[model samples]
Target: MTIYQKVQAVNHLFNQLDKDLGSFQQSTGLGCVANCGLCCLKPDINATALEFLPLAYHLLLNGETEQWLEQLQNNTEDKLCPVLNKVIAPGSKGFCSDYAHRGLICRLFGFSAMLHKNNTPTLVTCKPIKEQKPEAVAKANAHIASKDNYPLISNYYMQLRSIDESLGEELFPIRIAIEKAIYAVLAYYAYRELPSKDDIV
Candidate 1:
C-alpha cells in the first residue's frame, strides 16, 4: 500500500480504538486525572513508527517535517516524548501538543487490557489510576474478564501489523519512533508526487 493508504489505515484503527475505549471508560469510570500528563514524562516510553505515521504526515503537510526532525535530533537528553507539552510550573498538568495524532500506546494505556501468561486479561494501566480508582479498576478488570468486547492490546497491535509489518513490529524510544515515521513519509514523497491541500485534510 501507499504511504497515504497506510496512514489512513492506521488512523482508521485509531478511530475505532477511540470509540471502543470511550465505551470502555464509560463502563468502568476509570480515566486519567484531569489535565494530568505524568505518564508522558516517563523517560522510557517506547513506540512503533507505524503509530506515528499520522503525526509525521501532519508535519509534512504543514511544512514542518524538517523542523520536527531537527527538534527531535536535538533532544539527546531527558528523552521525554517530544510530542509531550510538559508543564513547567509546579503542580500544573502537561498535555500533548498533537493529541489527535498521538500514538496507539497513548490511547491504550488507561483503557485497554493485555492477556497475562495464564491467559487471563489484565488491565494495563498506570499507578495513579490504580491508587486513585481502586474500585473502578477492580470493576474494570472484572468487566474485561467477563466480557470479550473490551479492547485487547494484542489484537489492536495485530491490526497495526496487518497495515505494514515492518513499521508496526519494532519499538523504539518515543522520539526515535517519531523520527523514523517522519523519515518514512519523507522518503515516500521523495520519488513521488507531493500531496495537495485536500489530501491531508
Candidate 2:
C-alpha cells in the first residue's frame, strides 16, 4: 500500500481508540486535569515513525513539511515535543498545536493500560489523576478488570506494526519519530506525483 493509504489506516485505528477512551473516561469519571500539560512536558516520550505519519502527511498537504522537518532536525536537545505550545513552565499550561494529528503516545498516555508480569492490564495514568481522583482511578482500574472494550497500549501498537513492519517497529524519541515520518512521506512522493487532498479521502 502507498504511504498515504497506510497513514489513513493508522488514523482510522486512532479514531476508534479515541472513541473508546472517551467512553471509558465518561463511564469512570477519570481524565486529565483541566489545562494541565504535565505529561506533555516529559522529554523521554518515545514513538514510532508510523504513529506520526498522519501528522507528517498533514504538514505535507499544508506545505509545512519542510519547515517542521528543519525545526525537528535542529532540535537535537530533544526537549519537549515540537508541536507543543505555550509551555512557559514545565508541567504547566500548554497544549499540542496540532491536536488532531498527534502521535500514538500522545493519545494513549493518559487513558490506556500497561500489561503487568502476570498478564494483567493496569491502567497507566498521570500523577495529578492519581492524587486528585484516587477513587476514580481505582474505579477505572476495576472497570478495566471487568470490561474488555478499553483501548490497550500493546494492542494498538501491534496494530500499528501490522500496517508497516519497518516504520512501525522501530521506536525513536518523539522528535526523531516526527522527523523520520516527514522524511518518509517526502521520499515516497519524491518521484511520484503528490496526491491531492481529495485523493487522501
What total of clashing residue pairs does each candidate reach? Answer: 0, 0
Can you tell me which runs of candidate 1 are displaced by over 4 Å?
Answer: 88-94
Please give the lDDT score for candidate 2.
0.87
lDDT of each: 0.90, 0.87
**lDDT of residue 66 for candidate 1:** 99
C-alpha root-mean-square deviation, each candidate: 2.2, 2.8
The sequence of per-residue lDDT tens digits that candidate 1 reaches over residues 1-201 is 999999999999999999999999898898897766889889999999999999999889889999999998886885999988776455534478778899999999988999888888899998888898998899899899896589999999999999999999999999999999999999999999888758773
Which residue pairs clash in candidate 1? none
Best by lDDT: 1
**TM-score for all models, in order of appearance:** 0.94, 0.92
- Write candidate 2's Cα lDDT for 133-180 as tens digits: 898898889988986677789999999999999999999888989999
